[model samples]
Target: RFPRNVQLCVLSFLLPSDLAAFASTCKRLVSLCRRDQRLWFSMCHRRWGSQTLINKWGSGRISYRRLYRILDEYKNLIGFWRRCGDSAAPASSSPPPVFFEWGPSYIAGSRVFPSKNKGYDAMIEKPFLWMSVAWNRKAMNYLDSDGKFVLNEEDLIGESGFVENELIRVNVGKNKITYN
Candidate 1:
């Protein structure tokens, strides 16, 4: 049998579902899988180490396992996204495409606009949405209309059809987007 450290290293490589299944095999493994900080922290670091500061997330108040769940749930959103249907904003105020990025303590969506320069094909990013864990460990999403990180309580509907006061929910499917 491998030593505890080695076993934990191996367990760190497993998906959460697989680890849960393995943990059910015996009392020893169940205890190890449930209480080992290194295993869960390693799992988070391995997946998102380069994109974000894993340790700084949740302000050291939440467990790494919970943090892992939060990151995994929203990981697919870390890229450019364009609305597929009719415009959600007024015709006179057509909105630009948006890009999502990772942050030390949150995931932010920003408005992307073409550069004003004559020939430089660069895009500019303006902060639009900020998503982080709340005091209750729930997802807290805020929309900043002025891109100034100000938390406005007014119910503002963004170009993405998302409301400032509502939780941003997405239903991803294997072949198409579906919801339950």
Candidate 2:
């Protein structure tokens, strides 16, 4: 029951501190307890500004992966809603987006291993927002906050998908692992 004209800057991310104490006052949106820039922009800014807001939201205190996931999901949702609402939209506007482009497919060869000193967790923790697939002789490894190491795609491996870009958080061991 909010007026569409509500000012954008006042719709805070509900940050506990000063930025916009008023944002925290919203009773229903308590789900997004953090100061998410996307919510703010959606309430106030135009669609084109979404990318900038997403980048800003990511660079803040939250982990890059979480922010990236939120932003990525937001983008997908926006596209979905737009298309669903306007079935007659131009075909060019409704094409599938290539989020990732692997050589032929997501194969084991495009995988990286964990170093002895720095276990798998150490690298995954780093800010690795997956986008525009790039070619690399060395594939990437993901070590989640837990000690578990996931070096392969989850599609075939199932729940074994490595922690998404948060690997450096664990201690790696010198165990050689390879699959044919």
Model 2 segments more than 4 A misplaced: 1-8, 12-16, 19-26, 32-37, 40-180
Q: Scored by CA lDDT, what does every candidate get?
A: 0.72, 0.33
The candidate that achieves the highest lDDT relative to the unseen native structure: 1
Lowest summed lDDT window (length 10), candidate 2: 101-110
TM-score of 2: 0.20
lDDT of 2 at 15: 32
Q: How far is candidate 2 from the true structure (C-alpha RMSD, Å)?
A: 18.9
TM-scores across all candidates? 0.75, 0.20
Candidate 1 stretches greater than 4 Å from native? 88-94, 118-120, 149-180
Expressed as tens digits, the lDDT of each residue in 20-85 for candidate 1 is 999999998897888788899999998898998887676566788888998997798889887655
Local accuracy of candidate 2 as per-residue lDDT tens digits, 65-149: 2443333433442221111344576866663321221211221111233355776564212221122111221222333334344
